[model samples]
Target: MKTIYYLFGLVVMAVLTLVSCESKPSLQKYFVEKSQSNEFMAFDLGTDIIKAAGSDNLSADQEKALKAVRKLNILIFKSDSTDTNVVHYKEETTKVKSILKNGDYEELMRVGSGKEGASINMLGENDDIDEFVVFLRKDGVFGLIRVLGDEMTPTDVLTIMQLVEKSGVDMAQLQPALNQINGNKG
Candidate 1:
């Protein structure tokens, strides 16, 4: 009886150890506090999807539209990886746009593709913008973050984009993490 109990304890301890050692992968976090308007979003490169949610003023259709994007992963490719690649991910972002009709606000969305990216094109929208957003990883981890308010300026937006380009989660780090979690070698 004593040996059986010891074996059971060892098994429980092993399981707990595995669980604790599991890495918690998160999306690259990009946050800009005390700047820009009210905006919240997450672009999961792993899943090739972009999600933005904010304000009750949005219409049902807009919410549906946000959910409609089943595939947009092509947006996360490296710019210089292939020169012959016709559909360059970096430049492709300019062609992307979405409209959101929240309860009291109309959101015009524009997300960039490459390392340097931008979302929530609110400068031309309401005179006073208030928003907070994040770029979530495919694993549902939070990555880049953006919080904008009345104090956010156009230059601030540009600066934020630059920062994202310089430091957003790169594929180099992500692929290995995914492989480790899924027990597959890339």
Candidate 2:
């Protein structure tokens, strides 16, 4: 009886190990792999940068939301239908869709469609949100923004977005980088 019980326990452990190992790949890993090849433009912003970008005019809720955020990762891919690398664009879009669908992510909201598409998604376990993902495809550009936060709620995300829109940060600072990605001279 003891031998049988021990063998059953071992089998259960092996099954659990295999199941954990087979879990879907993280979105962060996918972003890093695609950005490392120089085919995509990537930006990583730590908490300090995010905090500094916010103004003193932030509301209590907005301030709390910002404090919960640990980091932000942005990846952009510019593709034109007439471009030779359009095939690569299609592959990337497909890969992103598959990853989101297969992973634990849940679609929070979706806006626009076809060429002008955008969506917001979240990856969470229990009541804690681990990451927030935003994918926007407009014109010939594809952009992904991943916000890593702790104990984030839906209200917190809304406040964060509101703060971002109201923040006086100058987006023109990114014009040079955007132009480079779009094959335009600054």
Task: Say which candidate scores most in lDDT.
Answer: 2
In candidate 1, how many Å is residue 85 off?
36
Q: Which residue runs does candidate 1 get wrong by more than 4 Å?
A: 1-100, 110-128, 132-146, 167-186
Cα displacement (Å) at residue 118, model 2? 0.5
Write the residue-wise lDDT of candidate 1 on 34-153 in tens digits: 112122222323212222223254455433332332222111222223554333432332222211222222344535553444444342333334443333222211133334344444
- Note the Cα lDDT for every prediction shown: 0.36, 0.77
- TM-score of the candidate numbered 1? 0.24
Candidate 2 residue lDDT tens string, 105-165: 8997899877688888898864688899999887667888998999987778777766656
Off by over 4 Å in 2: 1-15, 50-60, 80-83, 125-127, 170-177, 184-186
> For residue 37, what is the lDDT in candidate 1?
15
**What would the TM-score be for candidate 2 when compared with the true structure?**
0.78
Model 2 scores a C-alpha lDDT of 0.77
TM-score of each: 0.24, 0.78
Report the Cα lDDT for candidate 1. Answer: 0.36
